[model samples]
Target chain A: MNGTFDPPATGKRVIPGTYVFDGDAARRGFAINEMCFSFNEDANRRAFAEDEEAYMERFHLSEEHKKAIRERDVIGMLNAGGNIYYLAKLAGILKLGVQDIGALQTGTTVDEFKAALLAHGAKLKELQTQGETA
Target chain B: MSTIAGGIFTSHVPGIGQAIAKGLKQDPYWKPFFDGWHTVHDWLKREKPDVLVCFYNDHGLNFFLDKLPTFAIGAADGYRHEDEGWGISGYKPYPGMPELSWHIIEQVVHDEFDPTMCQKMLVDHALAIPVEMAWPDEEESWPFKLVPIAINTVQYPLPSPKRCFEFGRSVGRALESWPGDEKIVVMGTGGLSHQLEGERAGHINIEYDTFCMDNLSRDPEALLQHSSLDIAELAGSQGVEILNWIAARGAMRGSVTELSRNYHIPISNTAAATMLLENHETVLA
Candidate 1:
């Protein structure tokens, strides 16, 4: 509020490759997120694993949500209004670590995502070292 | 009156909990992050504050989008940690200081900050991981009582940094007003920077994170300049958890001295940090 900052160009500032998960998205993804929220329980996770389709039906998930889950498409899930935190439960059921989900979203291998993180960290270190020496 | 010893701001990534469960503190990937806790542990051992008022965001454990409060305070006798669907093993229920919780809640609400009062609440990794990291070796139970204050960072229309800072100041005033003689330590958990949602999933902003570590204790208002949306843009969506750190920093009402600080990057797609600040000449607001 203090600074003279420009307002976002569009009604919503579109950060490339980023989703804001705002109210619109929340309303859009409520059912899916609610279903993912239920995954907090081990029994629900087990039930989902037991009969994925039947569980989806119980949540009243739309075909779009069902397809996103079926394909294990993290980005598709996001497109369908799935918050990353709730979707994390789904990822857990699928045995996907955050790095795995990152890979899936970015279309990279898990190893590649890990390597990119390391490289980014190393870059930061290099910059800091330069700052110290400079 | 209750005395605020100081504050500790830490990252509460669930992966840290996973690392601890697997005894991988010494593993190469986890060592840098875990190593940062030594100074915090030493400080805690020496200070031994009676209660820790923790400011953290719940990750779909206690409150879902069904009805989320902007801020909530726990008034329970004990808080439980259950499986978060991510296989992070549960810990024994944490002892809660309901007397302190209710006192703060009453005072804060009187001060015109209405937070949802929970008689029973389930704490998630955001609270648990920091406790585990701070006191890794304690097997039986945590030495200090906990007062969990959850702020909503998960949903849109999140509280602004200015709002959280003011709420913390109110809580600080509440703590100072309490009649008990207990020593208290305030804690804020989560974020230096990292995102996990989109193509920007592995986003890490070293410059912003360093700025935060350097400025939080001395000039927290500098942090309040960024609106929630600005923070989401600058710190990554999840990185907005820095609001926890801001709120914790605001709770100290006296001159602050940075005791020790550590920042490490790429801890499970996040830049993790831990900082300890000692509040000197603790004064009434």
Candidate 2:
């Protein structure tokens, strides 16, 4: 433990690990409790908890779906896909205004927001071509 | 039951972690905070705990908006560091206490506290700050034995304050049953009251925070009955995250002799409260 600051006997100075059940830690963590849903206000968590139906009405989402999102039950959320886009809408979040719902729900939405931007550009070009230009 | 140093409560707020890395002995507001913490430093040196169970919430670091763990424990030899996007790179590595970590995992749930056990993970800034500041002498080359506790505070529908308290009791049970000559201490950090993000970014409820300081000490069970929304409403969204401290308290039993309590506001849009807890006779030098 001398001479210009050396590591322990192992030379690696192996610190203890961070995971308790490391076997399937990341995968299990992802599948089990994957989403992070938050409100800008606790009033939101409360009002929603008090009367979810009322809360859902406040947002663009449906009642039953709000329950899954709030509960953090991902499997249920995916199964009840009517309002799969509800969370995105509530935040006024746009993964591009138009998305292929079929792909988004299945987790195969290959296109990123940039692709959506490109699609918007195509629309602009069409509008210019068909312009009743002033 | 063996002597428990009780639990430590701290804010996993990213900003504080960043501030400490710059050698927090400076900065007008922070200078005082460090001066205050230095007392704890002195105390810790005298009563060096064999193992420290740190409770912190990861914010987009370690576990992100993509994937989050409810409760994760480190069972490896050393943990890796993180950047956290704030120019504050995390510790190179943090040593973990696997035995105590595992015992808590097995026994806690049986005590009605289902902990999310972490294995092969990284230490987010939330758990790193107070550890570094409080015990800076821990050698990364051969660091002190540490066990990192990552709580699911950031993601909504988090564990309730009462649940955290019960979980603490489970932790206590686990520690009591451990076979060792090691002195153990638990610490909870984060929030007497404060919030960040969105229109409520600057919210502070000094009164509610003081109330938390009191109730969390005496009647945490009653406090847990209150919805997470209440803490979020009073303290701001981030304020409710402090329920983990109540968990820290629950583990300490009804007899916590408070060593010291300090509360501060406007610490980068946070209401910061820090405390050292143990039974009266045990805490006395």
Candidate 3:
């Protein structure tokens, strides 16, 4: 499913810091996603953990996909066509939660990412309180 | 005719399953989220729906990217939860109502809304966690049978919110025409807003969530104004799960009234919400 990365139609607007995971990305990342999808089974996860290189070989991953997996680069994987939902299975095997991945992609420490989330929550609470009193 | 009891909509974040497993519902961080379920529990007990039609998305548990369907309905006699590659424990299988499932499938198909019919399907947290939340005590077996209607939120080119809402209305019409004395509750389980990918991973939009909670019952049509891309931009990438809520809302025919709602933020980086809507009018078949 990999060849040239044909960009999505001209009308689609790009959101900064966001990857849409459209058909182009899907085609590009199919091997990586297919491999991650296999991680659903314990034995497969074990197999991958036991020998990451061999496991990627079994899935016929491209050199780029293997590099991204080796470095644990979430954005790199996304750029290589790895959908977040499927990539999450691989993240589980690596003992990283969504927040950890968020921190990795956003270039923030885990604590800072968490603090930002908490601040967002606090802002919502303040808004609600104002709505109630006003 | 089977009665549509109402619709229950909530966020089905996987972390909630972990919280329940760890018995952390009363923990300061989780208390507000768990407290919201009191009204839902009371309503479920009082209404005693014989079957629950769940509108949820599968997060790589049942279907893979090989051949993802736009809409799929489970006609299995029972649905099981398996290990989803994550550390979350599995739940006991929920009994299914295959006859009712087939009825909805046939009815919706006849109504020109094509959906993949699965006589055997596995449910993920998107379907399981909400049931566990609603019936926390029912460990061995849940009281109500299940009809799982899975929509594809994991892939691009997802069915539009309008399409899902209309499919739900078709299912509602099917349920209304069924010649049974059973009461049914439809559930939409998924997001208010949360993104778990890219640089915008921890994104949450309370304003959009509030707009959804306020209008889902009173005026769901207002939601269709935003296209799927608009939702992803405003609600976050994963937040498009609100399509499930829209469909659940559509299933409630006749006048709908909001009974109770609870919305909390930062429940595993999500603006979690639970809502109950009741259908006041009974339609004669």
Give each prediction's DockQ, rounded to 2 decimals. Answer: 0.47, 0.02, 0.58
Query: Cα deviation of B218 in candidate 2 (Å)?
Result: 4.0
Candidate 1 colliding pairs, count: 0
lDDT of 1 by residue, B56-123 (tens): 99999999998899999999999999878876656878999998899999899898997999999999
Candidate 1: segments with Cα more than 4 A from true spot: A1-10, A131-134, B282-285
Encode model 3's per-residue lDDT on B178-257: one tens digit a residue. Answer: 88889999999999898988877898988888888889889999898887778998999999999999888888898898
Candidate 2, DockQ score (0 to 1):
0.02
Q: Residue B188 CA error for candidate 2 (Å)? A: 1.2
Candidate 2: residue B49 lDDT (0-100):
73
By the DockQ metric, which is better: model 1 or model 3?
3
Expressed as tens digits, the lDDT of each residue in B1-285 for candidate 2 is: 445665556555555665766666588757545555655666677777777776666655466545557776666666776544333463757667777778778887676655566677766566677676677676544235777777776554667676676677777777778887677777776675653322223446666776676666556676776766566666665676687687677667537665665555445546566666654323333
Q: Which residue runs of candidate 2 sit more than 4 Å off their true CA positions?
A: A1-134, B65-67, B90-92, B139-143, B280-285
Largest TM-score belongs to which candidate? 3
